[model samples]
Target: MSPLFPALRTADEKEALRFGEHALSYAELAGAAGALAGRLAGAGRVAVWATPTLETAVGVVAALLAGVPAVPLNPKTGERELAHILADSAPSAVLAAPGDLLPPALAALTRIDVVATAGAADLSAAEPDAAEPDDTESPALIVYTSGTTGPPKGAVLPRRAISGTLDALAEVWAWTPDDVLVHALPLFHVHGLILGVLGPLRRGGSVRHLGRFSVEGVARELTAGATMLFGVPTMYHRIAEALDTDRELAKALAGARLLVSGSAALPVHDHRRIAAATGRTVIERYGMTETLMNTSVRVDGEPRPGTVGVPLPDVELRLADESDGIGEIQVRGPNLFSGYLNRPDATAAAFTEDGWFRTGDMASLDADGYVRIVGRKATDLIKSGGYKIGAGEIENALLDHPGVREAAVTGEPDADLGERIVAWVVPADPQSPPTPEELAGHVAAQLSPHKRPRTVRFLEALPRNDMGKIMKRALGNGNG
Candidate 1:
């Protein structure tokens, strides 16, 4: 089997990674990561304090080189959640940048300084572990899911899954060694660490990370010849908002080869705004923690605003239990995680006997096979007035209204309707906010009358996780 990152071996002394002003060429990265990998070899498992820094990237790459499963710990995680993860993964030691203040929870474990290990090897002679994993089934990253349903479960991703997903995406997006990707996403999740960082390395391409997301930073990077941009909906939403005033930002975005959004559905409103200003359509893709990537809007395909395009190569996707063209998305592919860590029962429950992994997301397939995700079956699927409604569509409609700045839709038990649609909105003008009647009328006019919000509650902002995904469970929990 080929190495996951061929660039680490064969690429020239060109810069491979940059976070803010700091950078490492291909040779420097190899030296740093190789030195750390040699030290990390035979370590059972290691936890990386996954901060948005060059050290975090080096730590993860080193762990992979050592044939060790690296668990990425979100730095923003609370003490209780952090304790649960440390206990669950049971890493022998932690890898973090020098001088980073780790919480008391991590103090019990031995700490390996990542930056201190750099330049410890001969730069020209440094090479990563040549031996590939035992046929790619070997564990690479143990990523924990956002604990929306319950406690976060670690999804054990294998070498094959990482390489498979990146290869499939490369085919669809026309990703190449010439492409320079830029993003400001956190390094903890799949969108950031796996795709935003590792994707470029696999293609032997360069990546520039904005340590913090800013319109100026995006403009600066893209203007300096970055070909691709990856961001979640919230980040793209900021870009859309800034494009009206920042001509340089719009010009930079227009010059990019590809702009992609994921982690959540980007509103149709923001999509139109960006396309109008920059003439560049931001494509959306669908995937989960268990499934690295299932579908994507192809570079050559029609740039649909709302749909997440078609399934990628080698991924067999099906919408199980179809009713009104909406069903649970189940998939089977090489790009799937082996299972949740140490929870055989939970893992068994996640898949069918025939081998399809049950993705709890509810979506509908168009005639052209484009997947339009509505919402989660647990929270976003509202069965009301003898009709099953998707909260995503209603939320999008509410967003179309001039008065609604940010919107989240949920279903509440009602006496008349089986479950009534409730819109938690951050209005554009809070002092003279759109009333429940006006917002309901706006949605009713856009969509069907039944899809309108039965109750409209105004908020200053929506409750969101580190990834910018709205926490539907936390809605009406006194946080909003």
Candidate 2:
């Protein structure tokens, strides 16, 4: 079997990773990770304090090198959520950067601080036998899902899933060693760690992490030869907002080879704004923790504003029986996860009787196979008065209004309507918000009268997760 990252052995001196002021070449990374892999050789599973740091990257790499399944814990996780993950994964050791202030949740686990060594030569020489697992089916990562429905379940991703997804993306994006990726997304999720960090490494490319996202930071990297930018809608929204007055930022974005958005749908309004300013169209992709990647707008294909493009090579995607062409997205591919760790029933339930994983996302496919995700099946699909409505379309319509800065659409129980659409809106001006009737008229004009919100609730902001996804459950609980 071939190595997941062939560059580690062949291109020893090429720059591999950069986080703020820290950097490591391919050889140096191998040496550093190899040293840690030696110590982790027999470990069952390890937990990584997944900060946007070089050590977190090294720790995960080392665990993969040693054939040990790694669990990445979000640094910002609350005490209860943190404890749940810790107990669920039950890692043998906890990997952290030296001097990292760990929460009480990780106090009991054996701690291993990942430190940078001298060079690749010293560490490589220390363990020539430290090699990646030959079996592609072996578990590589145990990433936990956001427990919106229940306690977070661990999604065990195999080595093949990572390699297959990256290779497919490499082909889709025309990714190469010359391409330098830039982003500041959190490392605990698939978007940042798997694609942002490992994708570059697998392609023999380099990644420049901003540590934290800023308009200035993005401009500096892009102007300094970074070729690609990866971000969620919030980050891109900021970029779109800044491109008007910030000439440097606009120029930097215009110069970028590829601008990609994922984790959540990027509003079409923001998409057009960025394109109008920079002459660059942002690409969107769709995937989840269980499925590394399923669809993406191809670099060589049309850069559609609102649609996530065709399925990757070897992925089979279909809409689960709907006359309107909007249904739950079911996918079957090599990139699919093995199962939810330690939850056999939940794992079994995740897939259909025939084996396709139910993505739990409501979506529609165009004539050309582009995927437009509507919303989550559990929350965003509202059956109101004999019609099925997707909250995402309504939210997009609400966002188009100049008076609305932020918007999330949900459905609440109504005695007459079964479920009535409710719009949670963050007004652009607190002193003068668009009236409920005005916003309803706007949505009705754009889409249909049925899609218009029955009630508009004014809020300072919509509740969001780390990935910038609107938390509708929080809104129902009066937390938003």
Candidate 3:
């Protein structure tokens, strides 16, 4: 089989990764990861303390080099979630940085400390010739899903899925080794660990990770030669808010080659704000843990503010039959996970009879094949009195109001309307919150009258996960 990262052998000693004060070159990374891979060659599976650090990157790379399935555990995960993952994956050993404080959940597991070996003159000289695992179908990583309804299921991703997704993105983004990617996303999720980190490595490019996300940090990296910036909606929202007052931030962002957003939908208001300030449209993409990536806006294509452009090369996408042209996105592609680990029944239900993985995300495809994701099927799809309304459209409408700073919409049981739309809003000013009637009229004016909020609840902030995705279930349960 061809190597996943050929640059590890061919590329010159250019910088490969930068996290905070630490940096590693291709040669140095190979030496460090190769040395660690030799020790992990026969491990059943390894768990990585996925902190946004160079050690975490090196640890995952080492596991990949040895063809061992690596389960990346979120450093900030609660004790319960962390314990669940540990029991579920049953990793033989845990990989962590030196002198790191491990939680009690990982106390019983065998620990392997990942250390910096960049200064070692012959770090790769005496590396053992470990036999590579020949099967591409073998699990490379077992990523856990967010347990919204139940315990997080482990998605068993194969080596080919990662390779296929990265290659397809390379084509769409015009990605090259000369590019430098920058982001401050967490390291456990697919968006951060796989794309933000590994995507650059696959192309022989470098990555500069902001240990913590800040508008100042973004400007610093971009000013220092970073070409691409990756962030979620919250991060972009901050950027949009700061561009007006920070001249250096605006100038630095305007010079960037590409700006990308994912994990959650970027509001059209923020999109327009960033474009007006930076002259760069933020590209959006859609994917999940089960599917590494299905669609993305091409570098060569027009940047539509609200659309997550065409299906990637070799990915087959089709909406389930719907009269309104919006339905659950079902996809068939090489960039798909093998199955949910140890959950045959659940895995069997995730796919259709014809073998397409049901994405559970509601989206519409334009005539030109642009995919505009409406929302999730279970939470964001509202069946009103007689019409099926997507909560995203109404939320977007709510976001357009100057008084609204953040918004999340969900449907609740109502006898009169069958299901009434409820808007959870974080007002722009606490002293003068937008009245329910005024916000309702605002949404009614923007969209149809039926899409207006029947009930409006004001909050200081929306409850969000680590990735900045609103936890709608919390709102549904009256916790927000």
Candidate 4:
């Protein structure tokens, strides 16, 4: 269903989002969302598909402003995937292209909201009613995550779910109207929606969102004065590669106000190298779909190499481990989601009897409060011969190797050792694959023998979803 975009209470005149040749003012974006929201105001549930480009970005902001729960989905998806989401969601309608991603026979998608072409819909959607919405807070989104089930589960995020994120960042990472963000990440994920768009937009900053990430395109946008940058490790690796042939572009990226890396673990080598190459640390942060983001490296202080920095404001973190002090991470805060949509059993399983939301991530807290995420609580790690091996740490170490460009480490069952480290990597050059022995040797020197990958396979690129998360399930099942 189409959502009405709300007008920004504090909007900047200079900063505008450029989607292809078309550029929309803050008012226009708000208007589009308002138009969508107008239609969705009565029904109250909508799923949007416009890619991460200009049109979709506007649509999301509008939904939130209208106080309607708008779900952003991967555009590349077909009727099968969309059908599952719509059937489960029971949205009022779907605001999408003529051949929308959703399956037929699902509810919502009425004549009022459905449009003929890709042309921009009017600011007024629905019955053009002027009934002011209540200050009510229910589910604002049904954010689906990378789960075991073939059909993804949606995390129910409320209006208050995103406030703590902005407040926490403000307490540490300074944001202002002068700042302009280069948002190339997908909108389907929490990072792109909450931090990428909402965070900057809330602070009255401009976001130059791209339909898809392109190194040269992003570099050019930065050169044009986009100040903030945030991306996953793979995106940064590509940025680093682009900077090599385009030194000027690298210089441009170095000029940003703040640079951050998240969504997936950012390799330390890539983190430092990108910083050295572009003159920015690209502060690494830790978060998940359940909790928007709890930890991030400081802008002024030393961003500890492996850690995802300290907990954000209102977020309390502690390790559940008794021995090594590294187990599952537990968080308590407003930024956390209410629960899974229509999945009461899952919601009950998500948290302890206490209020704290049980983040599936495994991490260790330091004396200074900095937290380093090791792995997921449920099967994202390998323990071979009594030594724990996290996919993130090994993958980060692998990417540090000059020949390796992208890598994903997963555990395979072994009789002798409960689980052994197995890595699937994408070399910078396909023809010149990094030798398994050489890669293993590099990891062995850096990590313990148990932590070292027992087997390595070279591929063109790692399997990833629209949000840029490495699909380990795909790899484990050989689907990747």
Candidate 5:
């Protein structure tokens, strides 16, 4: 097999990466990462402090060049969560940018400060101690999941999983080296690091990170020749809100080749608004930590407003335990992670006897085979009055209401109904918020009466994780 980053081996002096003001050519990046790879020889596994910077990118690339599995640590992680992650994925060393004041949890490990322009050797020649380039099955990364229910478990991703997902995306999105992608997503998650950073590198393309997401930053990069844009629902929502007043933002978006939203379902309201303003339909894709990517709305196909398009080239996907169409999404594909690190029992339980990995996300396929994600089986699926309801649809319906700015849907215990639908809303006009009756009627009219929320609670904002997914479990009685 060819090397993971063919561009790095070339004498191409073209700009390969840019983070804020820092830039690196393919030759410069190759030299820096190669020198670091040589230093990382014999390392079992290294933990990278994932900040949104060039150093973080170089560090992970160096680890990959050395064929050592790199575990990325979220910079904003709390002390408790950080301690738990360290204990769970015990690494021999930690990689971070120079002068970063690391937390106490990382003090026990050896620190390797990553420098962007310190090396002088190209990475075309393999280090004597590094693993062979064809070792596709070797563990390349150990990413930890958000432990919403329990402690976070490490998902062991192999070299092939990274390459396979990127290549499939390149085909479906018509991605090429000419495409210069832009985004301000965090580096720890798959959407940000693997897709945002590694995706461009694998395609021999360029990526310009915003360092921090802002309407101005997005406009600056896209107007400056970035061909593609990546973002979560929250970032897009802000763009949708600003489009009417920000002509530059709208113009920039209209000029781009593609606008992709992932990590959470983009509200149909925002999707429609952006498209109407800029004439660019924002496409959506579906994937999780365990599976890097499964399905996407193909560039060649019609842009379905709500569906996540069809399965990628080699992925086999099916619905399990169907009821009225919606069911748990299960997939088997080369892009899947090997297993949960150190948890053989959990790994075994995560898949079916037939080897299809259970994604736990609930979705239904359209007549033409497009995938529409409903919600997760654990929290978003609500059984109300004998009907299995997906909260995502209801949430989207609520978002369409002019009075509602933000929304989350969940289920609560009820004596009459097995589970009653509850809507947690942040009002567009808090002073004179729409009555619960109005919101309920709006949802019922859009969908069915049974799907309407039996209880409507108002809040300033719905709780969200770093990736911008609404934390439905956090919406309890007192909070709203």
Candidate 6:
């Protein structure tokens, strides 16, 4: 629970981060974070532009260490979204990459200090008390959701939440000092910040960060050497698509000791393809904004295709209704968030009477302890003519079809059926796009007639937010 960055630095001086053409040692990075934290303490709520870079990483830790409540924002945020977050966080100070990238509103803001990506000066000698958090229960970060379903809400994560997640991940993934984590996910996301930045630092390991990810770019990083590679399903699928045939991505994933996937469902097809391409089973896990991560594919045994493996240490998962094998996934663990910031009403509604965080996700668990996610609490299944249907089931079946590249299924309002399945998809070959009739025929062979999509809409590409999550709500309600 102590400063994780300092812990990593103490463990290995040579621990360095890869940024562009330079390599940054742990000692230097820690010093910069400490000094910058000292400079940015005036902002009661500080918003730091988040991206996967050595500078962004240090800036976040610096703000927190400075006792400024930190809010991580997307770099590409437009005027409206940027204003909302900036106003909500109300940062009196700003620490940003130099140039016009800093908000114009920032000029009027008092006590603002902008630190260039050109690492801050060393502060080992002048290190402020920096108000090292005395208790793990204190808030360590504030991250805003993309608000695809509704307005974005800020989730406040305490030290316990992050530390507990790192501890749980270290055990589940068997991360150690010997490992080098390769980070490619965006920093604004919890998956990138928690798993990419904090998770590695807690285990006293180093990180190799890329500003962006391309099939070829990641391919090169996979070759650069690392003990573990963590990414969302989209990244893994891209890597799988570009790798060798026989050994698949085995040679590409040559240096990695393990691969972990979360942030979104890791489709069965993509999971198998990654294993076939790289000879490494891409371990798909279950987690969300409220909880950093709870379940993951184990290091040793079967990394099943769809299941998110078992719960991590100190975390317990159970169905709200135990009799049914599948129900709301309720969890009790240190890794869970403190609550939504400034929303006591929401906080009260987030947990059950008994205190488990009600993960909106619906899931089913096997006797051997493997768990497969079914749907979201707000929107995972559809009801039609009093018959319930799992959207993932239909989407997965559609994805298996050779012509389908990506698929998302949602239940749409129907006058007769109450709600019916509607599928939006992207074909593998745009020129040879499959007809709705063809897709319906393809899924009917696999899915129950009741579960077959009532409507299929072909999209050049499914509408997804910056994080690559397929926006089913947008597709179904005619919002996009």
- The C-alpha TM-scores of every prediction are 0.97, 0.97, 0.98, 0.88, 0.97, 0.92
Query: Where does candidate 4 stray beyond 4 Å?
Result: 1-7, 10-16, 97-108, 111-136, 428-434, 477-480
**Residue-wise C-alpha lDDT for candidate 3, range 337-372, written one tens digit per residue:** 999988999999999999999989998889999998
Across 209-236, the per-residue lDDT of candidate 6 in tens digits comes to: 7677776555566677677787777787
Task: Mark the 10 consecutive residues where model 3 has the least summed lDDT.
Answer: 121-130
**Any runs in candidate 2 off by more than 4 Å, and if so which?**
117-121, 124-126, 477-480
Model 5 scores a C-alpha lDDT of 0.90
Q: Which residue pairs in candidate 2 collide? A: none
Model 5 CA deviation exceeding 4 Å by range: 118-133, 477-480
Sum up the clashes in candidate 5: 0
The sequence of per-residue lDDT tens digits that candidate 1 reaches over residues 379-466 is 9999999999999999899999888899999999888897888999999888989889999998999998989888888999998888
Per-residue alpha-carbon lDDT of model 5 for 387-443, expressed as tens digits?
A: 999999999999999999999999988888989999999999999999999999999
Q: What lDDT score belongs to each candidate, Candidate 1 first?
A: 0.91, 0.90, 0.90, 0.71, 0.90, 0.74
What is candidate 2's local distance difference test score? Answer: 0.90
Steric clashes per prediction: 0, 0, 0, 16, 0, 5
Report per-prediction Cα RMSD to one decimal.
Answer: 1.7, 1.6, 1.5, 3.7, 1.8, 2.6
Query: Candidate 4 lDDT (Cα, whole model)?
Result: 0.71
